[model samples]
Target: MPSPAPWLYWALLSALFAALTAIFAKVGVKGVDSDLATLIRTVVVLLPLSAFVWLAGKWSNPTALSSKALIFLGLSGLATGASWICYFRALKLGEASKVAPVDKLSLVLIAFFAVVFLGERPAGREWLGIALISVGVIVMATKR
Candidate 1:
């Protein structure tokens, strides 16, 4: 059998870590202020990421990036911070299974955004997959 693509490997790792994040966050937020929990988590992530960039000699000259790139990256970071705050708050109040599935609804939005903003046209089968994901999320999110 042929090896999977590099992107597939990375994506699988992402999924694994995301699952862990939901589980861990669900537990960590218990009896804690959700915003404070998010702050602590952000610190944990920042410390390791900073160490990795510095120790691995992967640091880049921020000035070299174009203004547009910088602006977009800044906006993306803000969006991420907002998302983390909301996610932690939700996990504090809801079951991880249901919360995680609702969060995955972003996948459907990503597919639409990629086509509309990135001009990337997915094949018909890909659209079918997106539709299924949409339906699955609805099913998973609904109460019995």
Candidate 2:
């Protein structure tokens, strides 16, 4: 088969890392306050990410971007922080299998939000995939 797009490769890698994050965070949060654990994780991420930004020389480029890009990036950072805080809390209290699926409900929300806020029109197949993801999350998150 022909190779998939480059973005698909990155997306698959992202999913793999995210799965590992749930497992690792679940173990890391044991006997620790979830918010504090999230803070520690943030520091862990920052240390390496900072080094990467410096090594890649992308740090100064942020200033070259428009103020609108900076503002949106700042907002995205805040949202990511909030998501991590809640995710750690959920992992602390619930099984990773359960929490992970519910956490992924964000994908369905993202599809809808993109259409509404970003004016991105998904194709019919994409909408079907989104609907299937919504249903899978609901099924997985529901208690037996």
Candidate 3:
């Protein structure tokens, strides 16, 4: 059989690291303010990401980018900052297992957003999987 796509491998690795991130953040945010913790986490991520881009010789002049690119990236950055702040707060207040599963609801939302905004048509099986994920998140997040 053919091997899975490189993106799948990288995405699985991301999932593993994300799990660790939630666990570590839960412990790290114990006494710290969630917002402050998010700030520190951002610094840690920024330094390494900056170094990686430079070392990979992929760094480019930001000002040379098209206005459209800049605007989308700026908006994406804002959304990421908000998500991290809220995620940290949730981690600080709830169990990682519960919080993280609830957070996967973003996957369902992504499917909807992609269809609406990106005009992507997912196959029936894929839509079924997304529906199951939505149901799972709702089931896990609600009280019995």
Candidate 4:
């Protein structure tokens, strides 16, 4: 059997990470406040990421980044932090199976933002996937 492409492998790994994140977050947040839970999770992530950053020598590459790129990267980090906080809070309050699908609604948000700000248009299949995701989220959000 042939090896998967690098991007394909990374994508698959990312999906697995996302699945584990929800399960672990749910377990970690059990009987704990979401704010504190997120803080603990941040520490958990930071320790390993800091080690990887040091190992990768990115800590010494400050001169390689343009000022604008650095600013945008910082902003992106802030945005991601905010999103993670909200995601953990939602996971703590809701079922992981439901919250995971709802959180995935971000794909639709990303698609809309891409069209508006990036001038990128989605192909027909992409639109269909977005629509199905939207419908699924709506269905999941509805309580019996």
Candidate 5:
């Protein structure tokens, strides 16, 4: 049998970790404020990521990056921080099952944004899948 694609493996692992994040955040935010919870989670993420960068010899001087790269990366960092804060707040106020599916609505938005912003066209089948995901998110998010 042929080996599976590398992106598939990493994507699966990321999905698994994301699910765990939702569950853990839901539980962890029980009594703590969501903003504080997000801060703690950011520190926890930084420790391992910092070690990974160091151990893998991936560290580089940020000063060498171009202005566009710096600006986009900085914006991405801000968006990520905002996303985590909102996610933590949602988890604190809602059931994980509900919150997680609603969060995955980003998948649909990602496809749309990729098409518009990146000038990439997804095949019909891919659009079908994205549309289905949008419907699924609506189903999961709404009251019966």
Candidate 6:
């Protein structure tokens, strides 16, 4: 094939991985502690990510990354860990469909944070997307 169009493949793979993650996590948490389950899931994730890092030869490029970049990466990792903890706990206590939609509201929080901290100037389209996401979350929350 002609290089297998990168963006399309990546989007599809990301969706597949996200869906699989929720289902697998939901099943994995059954009869198991959520925190321990999240830890196990992280271990599973690290295997593939570690292989990709090694294959990309990023281990030798220590100096190329700035301290600011490293700091942001560490912060992002911390946020992701916190999100996973909340998500698993929510899944353990609530319906998967419900928890998933609530977790997705993080996109709204991220967009607002980007504007406040990253000085991001979102265009009209992005603003519209944020509004729609907000409405969806509200609707999901209100449904009995």
The candidate scoring highest on TM-score is 1
Candidate 1 similarity to native, TM-score? 0.96
For candidate 1, the per-residue lDDT at 144 reads 72
Tens digit of per-residue lDDT, candidate 3, span 96-138? 8788889898999899999999999999999999999988887
TM-score of each: 0.96, 0.94, 0.95, 0.89, 0.96, 0.84
lDDT by residue for model 1 (68-136), tens? 999999999998999999999999999999999999999999999999999999999999999999999
Residue 52 in model 3: lDDT: 100
TM-score ranking of the models: 1, 5, 3, 2, 4, 6
Of candidates 5 and 2, the better by lDDT:
2
Count of clashing residue pairs in every prediction: 0, 0, 0, 0, 0, 0
Candidate 6 all-Cα RMSD: 3.5
How high is the lDDT of residue 16 in model 5?
A: 95
Between candidates 3 and 6, the one scoring higher on TM-score is 3
lDDT of 4 by residue, 1-144 (tens): 998788998898999999999999989889999988888888999999999999988786776889999998999989989989999899888999888988989989999999999999999999999999999999988756
Please give the CA lDDT of all the candidate structures. 0.95, 0.95, 0.94, 0.91, 0.94, 0.86
Ranking by lDDT: 1, 2, 5, 3, 4, 6
Global CA lDDT of candidate 3, please? 0.94
Q: Give the winner by TM-score: 5 or 6.
A: 5
Model 4, C-alpha of 61: deviation from truth (Å): 3.5
lDDT of 4: 0.91
Cα RMSD (Å) per model?
1.0, 1.2, 1.2, 2.2, 1.2, 3.5
Off by over 4 Å in 3: none
Q: What is candidate 2's TM-score against the reference? A: 0.94
Clashing pairs in 1: none
- Candidate 5 deviant stretches above 4 angstroms: none
Give the better candidate number (4 or 5) by lDDT.
5
